[model samples]
Target: MPRRVTVLEVGLLVVLVGLAGCAGMGTSVESTATSTTDPATTAGATTADTPVSTPGSGYETRTVTLRDENGTRLATVDVWVADTFTKRYVGLSDTSALEPGRGMLFVFDGEDGRSFVMRNMDFPLDMVFVAADGTITTIHHAPVESDGDLTEYTGRAKYVLEVPMGYTNRTGVDVGDRLRVDGA
Candidate 1:
């Protein structure tokens, strides 16, 4: 009886081995190890030489022409206009350098007493507030990351022009300078 039981057990083992034939655990382990070491397999990994979007991340910039007080064409800039929430919040943040000719134009829906501050900005800029009738109400010179006790230029201006520091002086842009937004 013991010899017969032994023969039955051996037969069962052979049947199980035949049914589960040749599946490799090593293949799965090797694939996982290879993916772990491969840089391209890493999620959200990019090369250091990856090209970032020009004119910034959230901005939709277009070529714009601006003139100075003497009607001199100062620059042809890719002017970015703010429309969405992210664009409005992150206006010019991390911009350590600015092109001499380019600037941003902020447009509001209606005339309201609005104030602006330079928060998270890396460069000095001039804020020109304009009213509905294209009248510049006030000019605010804000330093880099200036969120101090800066006074708000109180006016009901619907437009705001953010230009580089000393740009107003160079272009002779003064208070009451009429600003015309093309296709506004």
Candidate 2:
């Protein structure tokens, strides 16, 4: 029988793979491998923040594909999935560079209170909030700034996708478009 991999192990492996994939072009990517916080804290962390390797494995890294209106595959990116508390909190905060085809995806438990704040963001990003049925709900083009009144985008979504700035406008990924993932 094949040995089974645990969720923590797979999470670590994906993070390692992401770090390894960032060699040469820019600086290295660091893992935000922190312990899980209490439920109260997690629920209160509105500002803050998986894969079978697909269906079976617990949080595997996959190639996320963004398609146009007529189902034309526009871009395929190797994204780090943030399904954990630590991953959610440390999302793209201190990363040196997010290459042309790389970004982070945030998956939450429910489909409400999905707000994002640019606390430690170093690069401009286009935030796309997705509903439970994979429909795009809202999109925000966020910049790298942390003001006292940091803007918070709240929507009804179970998934939040953060890509490089202008990606949405440039690729024509409108509000009703959908996102598909391969190699989960």
Candidate 3:
């Protein structure tokens, strides 16, 4: 003779199984939240030489050297390289202040007529446009707009470097000069 389970026993068994399933679900959700919030596990974690995240922006830094037509090195700059579309779109807008000898370099696939604007910039900048052969095509001394009317600076370039205002004048870097990036 076998003993049959009572109606109350079956109901209790169902409740216990449901509670077990919920416990597993809670643990999964908690772990997912923790991983997402942890900086080390995040997507843009910094590496030894490539810092993907800086104070105000997430960009990798590179060393750029500007030279005259005679191959005389004029200046060396630590620049944030904006190679992708997203990085180029954001640019230096998030940066609070660019230290001396520091700037941002935008790289494109090919040389073309490009336009840049000082959108939401806290400080002024000197935009240098470079051709495919590393020759500079144009330099614009852009000032901060107080009237909220942004101006577009257009030039033919495969690379565009933006530095502190008056950087070109101070360094004597003008159009027809050349620029080279280290470990490019």
Residue-pair clashes per prediction, in order, are 0, 5, 0
Spell out the clash pairs found in candidate 3.
Answer: none
TM-score of candidate 2 against the unseen true structure: 0.64
lDDT of 1 by residue, 1-184 (tens): 0012246645764564465455421110000000000111222122356432223555666444445455554433345675443354445554444433456666666766665666545556667777787767787666664556543434457766776655556555677566666665
Please tell me which model should have the higher lDDT, number 1 or number 2: 2
Assess candidate 3 and give its lDDT: 0.64
Would you estimate the TM-scores of all the predictions?
0.58, 0.64, 0.68
Off by over 4 Å in 1: 1-55, 62-77, 146-154
lDDT of 1: 0.50
Candidate 2, run of 10 with poorest lDDT: 48-57
The TM-score between candidate 3 and the true structure equals 0.68
Clashing pairs in 1: none
Query: Which candidate leads the pack in TM-score?
Result: 3
In model 3, state the lDDT of residue 75: 78
Please give, for residues 126-154, the per-residue lDDT of candidate 3 as tens digits: 78889998999998878776536667787
Winner on lDDT between 1 and 3 is 3
Please list all clashing residue pairs in model 2, or write none if there are none: 50-59, 50-60, 51-59, 51-60, 52-57
